[model samples]
Target: MSTRILISGASIAGPALAHWLGRYGFEVTVVELAPALRDGGQDVDFRGRTHLTVLERMGVLDELRALGTGGSPMTFVAADGRRMLHLPAEFAGGDVEVPRGELAQLLYRHSSARAEYVFGDSITALEETPSGVRVAFRYAAPREFDLVIGADGLHSNVRRLAFGPEERYVRHLGYYAATWRLPNDPGLPVGSVGLNVPGRLMSVGASHRDPGRAGAFALFASPELRYDRHDQAQQKALVRAAFAGLGWRVPQVLDSLDAAPELYFDSISRADVPAWSSGRIALVGDAACGATIGGMGTGTGVVAAYVLAGELARARGDHRAAFEGYERLLRGYAQGCQKGGDRTGPFLAPRTATGLRFRNAVLNRRWALDKMLELGKEVSSVELPHYEAELSGMAGREG
Candidate 1:
């Protein structure tokens, strides 16, 4: 008999995992906390090597390419409100940009037919026996599955119950970031504008094939601030406090904060887990190692899903073997992305005014930017292995 797997979260990681798990012949069920498919947020790019490979294998590479945002150019503005230098869109985002929810929708479409999904609910508790795991949902009857995977985000309920406390695994990078969509203003242009004031950044860019709407990100350097991730009021107050004294159009941006519907605010953080799996329970994506919120996080999630589901198929439903194989194959990749996140924080938000000036100088100098791009090419390059099992019929297990 095929193993039955319950996956939490239907975002990028969960649905991607479901695609491979279902093909590998496991019965897959995904549960998401969102009432329906979330359809908003800033576009994400699938750059680096491994992420592209994952998309190709899933047969969504063409769709992703078609949906890419190539028209949005970016400009870095000085505190004095002058365009310092114009940068290609790839500078702030990546090689390509697609909305976060677009990626989620693409993943869901690929996996939906073969996998079952339960929306508007979430896992509340997980109790594992020698043979399998018994899961309790917030509003549904308990059910048993051979394996349970948490593709949930940083504050994963499954991770807390199966592993330990979140604080033990999450490391904050001393910064807070918020992203949301707002109405396009006549005052702003169609391209992106990045405003910087040493350890702070505010920007808005054209959002996913849409001209009348734009996505904005506000980031600032700060120590960890205590607030409920689910508390909208608390989050709003925090954003207001962070940018209270800023001048010019900054006030206008802050005013839009309270009214935006799809606001996503969280600490710039990474998850560091010693081991990603325990018995019949495991974690993937941000629940395992988010590697921060740039291009790398998206890529890491895609690659992890491929490697994990591939291992499960190879092990023929042996949870231990599959889990170990998954770790061995993907740990190095995760480490590389994590290192990029660590380096990026200092580069993106320099501590001192002098340091910020130095960074801007680097960006302004063509040779320095070229050198950095060369270094990035070296770090992002990886030899990906095509899972013969997935390409062929061997990986698909009949559920």
Candidate 2:
């Protein structure tokens, strides 16, 4: 019988892994906590050849290119609306940029035919038996699978259940970020424009698809905050307090918070697990090695999924060998890509006037900006083996 694999999380990494595993003839099943797919998020990009290579292997590279957002330039302004510094699109957009929600959907569609997806459910418990894993779900009856993997985000339930509490793994990086939709002002430009004060930033950009709508994004430096992840009202209050005395359209953006239908808020953090797997269970993507933002996390997630699935195919039924190989080949490379997250908070919202001035002055130089861009490509580069098992979907893939 083919191996029965259970994956938790229907986001990018989960679906991407399912696609490759299914193509390898594994019986793949994915469970997602959300009722359905999520949509309408900030732009996410892929950098370097490693990221592009995985997308090409999945056969979704052209599709993602069609959905690409031409990259958005950021303009930082003073309290009174005078532009201080401008960063071109490539700085943040990388090689190709797409909305976060859009990428999630594309991955889901690519894997749905090959994998069974159970939505609006979650894994409550897992037990490894002699030959497989006994899994319990919130809404479905208990079932067993040959292997289990967690592709959930940093706050992964699977990791918490298999590993210890989240405190042991997730470390806050002294910053918080939030985003929500707002009414378009019509006067707003194509990309992001924001007011920056010491330790805070309030930015907005009109939607590329719908000119009548806009997105509000804010970043602030804080030690560490405690709050309910599901409570939007409390999150809104925290954001309002963080920017209370700020000038330049601050009130206008805050006023829209009450009317915004959805809000995405979280601390800037990273997850570091000493071991990637235990017994019949393993982890991938943010659940394994991830940074909250500016970590090339999205790109890293897909690449890690590709390598994880390929390693399994190479090992066939020997999961221990597969997991060890996956970590061996990818850990150093993943950590190298993840280091960028450590600089995100200070870069977006400097803690002091001197730091802010230095950032603006230094990044203003074209040579400095070019040098930084070159480094991103360098860190994300990695060589990968072509897994072309006979009858595998990736068989006969173009070089």
Candidate 3:
């Protein structure tokens, strides 16, 4: 039987789920809110075990390695622009690092030919009946699908329609981040450099190959600030307002903010749902469990895609069984990732001068940093069980 599946969001998780679902004989359709593939953003990486296995299974690992940013180095600079300490290329970016937009493009190219993509459209309503799921799109007619999955990011429309409000599940980590491409490179001596003030951190780094342009991130902790997630002007204004007095090439970077075509600003937040599926609908990726920025968002998205599709195929598209198994296996890991993100927030944004100094001292220690990298590499790649073989093998062994 051909399982008709409607997937919302066309970035990492949506396309990846479509890829595996189609391979298992499911007819998939992906609808993206954006008019086209977003081709600009900061670098995201594949880290922490399960994520690496997904890339290998997708046959894109070598291609990704070829396209790697080549371990961009990062330096910590004083407010006056004096370099305090710089990390070697090895420490800044993990084993694999690529622009978020570039990676999205790669996933889109890999899945678009085999799947249906409706750009500039979104789901307005979703109704799950006994026969199937009745779906209504903002621009398309009402249709039905055997199952519906939301692979959207933190602010997922599908979650709103199927589940209750986002506020019930989302936990704000009390920080915000903004990224944009700088018109001119900051002319840094190495891969990337950051300047830290009392409550803000700004980074400037050229694309390893393309020195003409650079990426900048200005982030800080703020417990009380409200702005529309989709409002670009308002977000840009917020960034400007927050960093008005920050020094060290910030003025130059901020000067180009208005001109950059793909600037992004969002609060660091995570979502934790008791269950990812209800009735005939399921949520994947950030919609179900968002670890925000540091908890390996890219990795979690990719891994979730593989696991969700694999579980459905194994169960012959049985929503109840698949969702239950998925939750049991993935819930703890997702919680751990979210905790990692929370832990990293304090490290990334030290509240006091003493904390910042201590962080720098630890990072400056060559032996300590090397030891950390060695440990990190060891746990970053995890071997995933092949669903088909594992299921049958376990049955046979038990019998």
Evaluated with lDDT, which candidate comes out highest? 2
After superposition, the stretches of candidate 1 with alpha carbons farther than 4 Å from their true spots are 380-385, 388-399
List the RMSD of every prediction in angstroms. Answer: 2.5, 2.7, 2.8
TM-score of 1: 0.94
**The CA-based lDDT of model 1 is what?**
0.80
Give the C-alpha miss distance for residue 195 in model 1, angstroms. Answer: 2.2
* RMSD after Cα superposition, model 1: 2.5
TM-score of each: 0.94, 0.95, 0.93
- What candidate 2 gets wrong by more than 4 Å, as runs, is 389-399
Clashes of 2: 0
Worst 10 residues of 3 by lDDT: 376-385
Q: How do the residues 290-350 of candidate 3 rate in per-residue lDDT, one tens digit apiece?
A: 9677777778778878888888887878878887877777777766666667755576668
Which candidate number has the best TM-score?
2
